[model samples]
Target: MSKEESFQNSVIRPVIKMLHDLLAVHFKHYMATKKLEFSQLSEKEKTNFIESSFNKDMAFRSEIRGLVIGHFSTEEFLLYATMQRGINKRINTILKERISSNRQNFVE
Candidate 1:
């Protein structure tokens, strides 16, 4: 891998994983409190649910963005952003797979 990619893998990736883990815990609590069963939501409802959850935490997102910006050089930050986009796409794919699996379980 290139140096930028190596840097991202070693450094930025851990931070991303930690943030995702933290969010996962928060989301688990939210789901429990709200009686949220992802399997039951229609596709539109699921989209709305995810959007609303993020919308409720703009400050958190901004804080994370600022943290990332502060930690990286401008060029590195650009690479980090690109890597984050890939990570996000992977996350979305995982979410879809999980929801689909849950729906299948419910159906069965």
Candidate 2:
């Protein structure tokens, strides 16, 4: 398949799905281990938690970027970066909403 086609069907779609699953799993584990809903976290704790999670996720994405650059052409690499940014933006929105809802759960 062409790079664009392969990227859409194989890379972007699967990666986005995987990222969502990863986020869900991580959040569940985090809450379980902390024994507190998001709202229960202090402001500093919340900052730390978000930073830690963001770093882990960014590291994962960096590894994927490295592998893609090694296997794909330069043009495809650019495309991949652009698509990744867009995908991540959407995921960020979902994460914010998830966190907000988690906080609300504790409020009620």
lDDT of all predictions: 0.53, 0.53
**Which candidate leads the pack in TM-score?**
1
| Cα lDDT over the full model 1 | 0.53
Q: 1-77 in candidate 2: lDDT tens per residue?
A: 66555665665445444454444555566566657576677877766665555456665435433433445557655
Candidate 2: where is the Cα deviation over 4 Å? 1-14, 18-22, 42-45, 54-108
In model 2, where is the ten-residue run with the lowest total lDDT? 60-69
lDDT of 1 by residue, 33-60 (tens): 5688866779778667656654565553
Which residue pairs come into collision in candidate 2?
none
**TM per candidate:** 0.38, 0.32
lDDT of 1 at 49: 66
